[model samples]
Target: MATQTAAERREDARQRYNAYVATCPSRKLLDTLSDKWVSLALTALAGGPLRYSELARTIAGVSQKMLTQTLRTMERDGLVSRAVTPSVPVRVDYRLTPLGEDLMPLLEAIKRWAEIHMEDVEAAREAYDRCSDSEP
Candidate 1:
């Protein structure tokens, strides 16, 4: 048999992973997706490129520091790209890279699902709290 290429070997290894396992590498990707800021930021950039201030505005309630942190992490993961335009005081823009855009649909769907079920979630939380308080 012919030797497997590096890409093929990596793909084969990835195919063997089960995210349900605690030590699986796929767990890291799940953890990243679990971040609220990441999902919001990705959804905002889903439309197109945006400036730092614009992203902050679009994703209401996100503090500057938090937005910076989120954007940096996204960029680090190859999900977003930051561009600086040297004009006047210098303008910076953030946009979803192709990979980020590819993930937008799923993110948007998840956001919608959360919004639609928020009332049910709140009710569940209240019920859970009542049950816990009564037990202890």
Candidate 2:
């Protein structure tokens, strides 16, 4: 019988660690994607580039501060590209980068799933609320 060396055991552990990391979302990425503001902002940008005001208008209910913060984070993440063009006033536009484009399908699937299951989710929430309310 052959004995496993310590080096071989370490390599096996490293491989398992890498496999786990590959499947898990980074905290920052999850924070970005799970934000309500981020999701709405990405969806609005999906229509094509939009000016700040256009994004603000399209997203509805987003405060200027929240939108600005979300855009800044997205820009920092390389998920969005901001352009400023010469105009009567400085024209600023926001568009998705290649990485952002890559995320569109995933976002779209999430949107579709939410739309399809919202009623079910709401029903579950209501049932839970009723049960909890009755408990004490």
Candidate 3:
């Protein structure tokens, strides 16, 4: 078999990337949004702007470092905005941007689906647990 040329390899990579993006556009977005801290942060900000400490308090089980990183990533993606106040204490606030607002309905739908199907999910989990217990 003949070896592929550099141009051919590049084209192949591009095609594969395009295919992956087309099939899983929401996968990437979901990966980001599904993160516990990110989801909680978005939910909290759904109401309005909040200070960093306020977010930290609202989102239980999130470490300060993880919250900071999640906020930074969201801000970089243009999903959230950060405002800084020039004061003696240097206050900072975070709020959802229009792009982030667009995700609200999607999140709400997911929440609804989860609520509706929770019993089914629980039953599946219990069945899996029983099968696993029986196997081993």
Candidate 4:
């Protein structure tokens, strides 16, 4: 057997990936958006640009550190853009990039689904807890 070149190996891996596969690259993206902070941040940005404090305020219960981390990751992924204005008191803002805007509708659907199913989700959680408590 012959050793495959790096490019050939990459192409083979790419061909093998399907979203349904556990090792698919897309899984990492899904994981990123699965974080509560990341989804909420994207949802908040869907409205328009907002400063750090504004996002923090709009997303209830998100800590400053976590919010900052989420924003950094989104920015790195090209999902959001950060602008820092030079001034005596510098102003920094974040907004969805074109790519992010393109992805927003699907994410919005996920958000809405959660909202529509909140009662069902809560009931399921309660039932699970009750059953677990009864376990030996």
Candidate 5:
């Protein structure tokens, strides 16, 4: 029997975890990425770094509490960095980290696909509802 190198062991561990499995830690990350606020925030931040108020405005219906919570979570997850500048009123800004930048393309593609296919999805929903209604 041969001992696995550190790199090989890390790769093996990564391969062992599947999101479909209930206990896989990756599911937690999927939950975060799938969040509506997170998706919107990521999309908005892709343009550039933004102040907290700017993010709130750009995302429309997100409440202050929710936005704050989401930003904190993103920061903890290493997906974003927050900087606070001391002044009379103070200034705070949020920006994507390198890991977050790597994730943006995937999220952007998902956003684009949803926008492009929304009509089709709506039509499918209507058809489904109509069929469901006629069933009984």
Candidate 6:
């Protein structure tokens, strides 16, 4: 039997969690990232830390329950930090952590790509529907 170095163990663990594998833990993270609420919240916080009410207002159409749930999930995943301030009304603020900051560029790029290509996507969808209608 041979002892593995720390780097080797880390690399082994990384290799084990392939997203393409059905049981890989990275799939869970991928699911989180694909969520609309998560993307919106992360991008909203990119400017700076936002109070809970501000976040709620910034992300219109998100119900209070969903917003709270999304924030809690992000916090648990170490993507965001929550701070509590003692005052007349206890204030809670959310800001992205270093790990979350590192993830921003990828999410931002995805957002940009989506915005840029949406018109093309819509045209494709319309063409597909027209073909389907003609075939039927």
Candidate 6 residue spans exceeding 4 A from truth? 1-11
Q: Which stretches of candidate 5 lie over 4 Å from their true place?
A: 1-10
Q: How many clashes in each structure?
A: 0, 0, 0, 0, 0, 0
TM-score to true structure, per model: 0.84, 0.80, 0.74, 0.81, 0.91, 0.91
Colliding residue pairs in candidate 3: none
Clashing pairs in 4: none
User: Local distance difference test, per candidate?
Assistant: 0.91, 0.90, 0.87, 0.94, 0.94, 0.97
Better of 2 and 4 by TM-score: 4
lDDT of 1 by residue, 31-105 (tens): 887899999999988888999989999998999999999999899898999999999889999999998888888
Ranking by TM-score: 5, 6, 1, 4, 2, 3
Question: lDDT (0-100) at residue 121 of candidate 5?
Answer: 100
lDDT of 5 by residue, 15-67 (tens): 88788889998899999999999999988999989999999999999999999
Write one digit per residue (lDDT tens) for candidate 2, span 77-130.
989999999999999999999999999999988988999999999999999999
Candidate 5 or 1, higher lDDT: 5
In what order do the candidates fall by lDDT, top score first?
6, 5, 4, 1, 2, 3
lDDT of 3 by residue, 1-136 (tens): 7899999999977776562575855557667888877877888899999999999999888999999999998998789999999997999999999999998888767777888999999999999999999994
Please tell me which predicted candidate would have the highest TM-score against the true structure: 5
Better of 1 and 3 by TM-score: 1
TM-score of candidate 3 relative to the true fold: 0.74
**Which digits, one per residue and each the tens of the lDDT, describe model 6 over residues 11-83?**
9988998999999989999999999999999999999999999999999999999999999999999999999
Candidate 1 C-alpha error for residue 52, in Å: 0.3
TM-score-better candidate, 2 vs 6: 6
